[model samples]
Target: MDIDHPLALLGGLTPRRFMKRHWQKKPLLVRRAIEGFASPLARADLLALASKEGVESRAIVRDGERWRVKHGPFSARALPAASRRDWTLLVQGVDLHHPAAHDVLSRFRFVPDARLDDVMISWASDGGGVGPHFDSYDVFLLQAQGRRRWRIGRQRDLSLRDGVPLKILANFEPEEEYVLEPGDMLYLPPRWAHDGVAEGECQTWSIGFRAPARGELVRELLQRVADEAAEETSPLYRDPAQEAVESPAAIPPRLQAFARDAVAAALKDAPLLDRALGEALTEPKSNVWFESSRVPARLRGVLVDAKTRMMHDSRHVFVNGESWRASGRDASLMRRLADRRRLDARELAAASDAARALIRAWCEAGWLHETGESHG
Candidate 1:
């Protein structure tokens, strides 16, 4: 994408301008962000996906002054009647299960893939809603079908209403309101409280970004780095000359220093940390799984699977929770694959023998497919 080129998706602001002005700082409302936009999946299709095992879904129903939430693999008989009011079914990671949904997700690739998360679809009945709440991550809410009335505010009070099944704001004060029609979109930065109520039956697509907390990020990276370090040769602490200590229960100062050095050694390896970060970022969600396939004896082109997560750094290429060292021309080719998600005949032909072998291995792992094959 041309970061300088204006986009209807960002209300005519270029991606560069939008990132500088509104991203994680304020809200943006774009009318007709997608001209004549329609949902990729119909209501019935969404219900079927929600009923499938391994997919994440939830049903929320409002009953007068009370609200209730339920998890799914919901059966067809488990959902509320079509005419029922004040109910919603939320299916997470729709892109992982449907090709059209994956295409819809690809539209937002202007953001880096590492931070871009999956698309979620919310199907709701008349008067349906999940109530006023704030997300810790940024989101673009696009109205796909029918209409929804949204009340929004930059909320200061983050307290939740006790006894509610959902994390609903207790003091939701709307400063602005709008009725979004099909193709309209609203972008909300993290912690911007908003409530959407369906005017009638409706569906909305939410493109959410990941914003891992500092501690969570550190913990994951450290764990990966330490695990890698453990596989390498390292000295064990040896206190051969110990003084007769009066405090047998207390940890020795020398032992503490050795432990500190062990951790420091792991953290000091810059390349290891970088590889770990790339692998962790590209790791698929826990519920995601891929089927193995036989590799073709000959290949002309390839397409990365929608369910596969691939990323690259200067020193390494990572995909599906695994990392490999990459440099020079091979690194460039791998990076291109990560960026474009496909390699045509001409591009594949440019790969060296080793790189071609790696590509075939990825194909056999079901991370990518031969040109004529269907995307996963």
Candidate 2:
């Protein structure tokens, strides 16, 4: 992607311009954004995935004015019939299950991988919808199979309906409305209230980005730091002074100081923080598992698994919840692999022996696949 050139996906604006103009600021609707777009997963294929364990799915049924939501690992027979009106099936993380969906997600690599989440697909019957709601993260709603009419507004009132499973807006005031067809997409920033309803049988693909809450991030990082702290064989806290306290119930101020010192010590390890963050970012989903494989006799190159998360900073290369200190030619090559998600024969040949051995180990662990000239 040329940063200076306008792209149809951005409604004829360059990525830089789009980011400056609309990202986290407003919404953009692009017609024919994916010209002649086709859905990656068919209806039957989607339903099959919904039935599988570990795949997150939901079914929402509209009962006149009231709505009901159900979690899924559903049998097809348990789902509402195709003839049933006003119901929708939503499947999350379609990108993880479908290769084409993953490819579609890669097009948005202009955004950093750390912030990009997975793609979700919603299949709906005529007159179906999940009602008016707002997401706390950025999203691109792409029409895939049929038409979905959308009403959007910059809502000030964030109140939700009482006793509802879905977080639906109680007072939805529409500022504009549009009917989206296949290849048309709408980008909405976080908390921009919007409602979408299927005009007929339709499928919509949503590429959502992650927005980590500050507190959540801090807690996770601290958890990682604390795990490392536990390994320290520090002597137990000792106050040898013979002064006895008058109040037996009083907590010691010296103990509080010791607690602060321990936290200060954790913060003092600068590289530890960086390593923990990298590990956190590359941590796999709870349901994700890699299949073990045998190593080949000779390695030519490697391709990262679609499910693998790989990234690198100045001192460390991170992949699949592990971090490695890299420098010189090896660091440069690994950084390229992180960026491209593949290492060609020439690039692989340039790596040091140790780096090559580590890569081979990862391949055997199923985080990557060894590629050769004849393999393709």
Tens digits of lDDT, candidate 2, 1-376: 5677888988899988988999999999999999999896788898999999999999999999889898989999989997799999999998887877888888788788888889999999999999999999999999999899999999999999998989999999989999999999999999999999999899999999988898988888899999887887876899997378799788798888899998998888889999988888898888777877887877777888888889988999999888999999999999998988899878888888899999999888788888842111
Clashes of 2: 0
Models 1 onward score TM values of 0.98, 0.96
Error of 1 at 372 (Å): 2.0
Which candidate has the highest lDDT of all?
1
Candidate 2 segments whose C-alpha is farther than 4 A from its true place: 372-376
Native-referenced Cα lDDT, model 1: 0.92
Of the candidates shown, which would achieve the greatest TM-score relative to the real structure?
A: 1
lDDT of each candidate versus the true structure: 0.92, 0.89
1-376 in candidate 1: lDDT tens per residue?
A: 6889999988999999999999999999999999999887889999999999999999999999799899999998998997999999999999998887788778788889998999999999999999999999999999999999999998999999999989999999999999999999999999999999999999999999988888988999999987887788878789899899999999999999998998887888899889888988998999998887987788989999999999998899999999999988889999999999999989988899999999999999899999989884
Q: Model 1, poorest ten-residue lDDT window?
A: 99-108
- Candidate 1: the clashing residue pairs are none
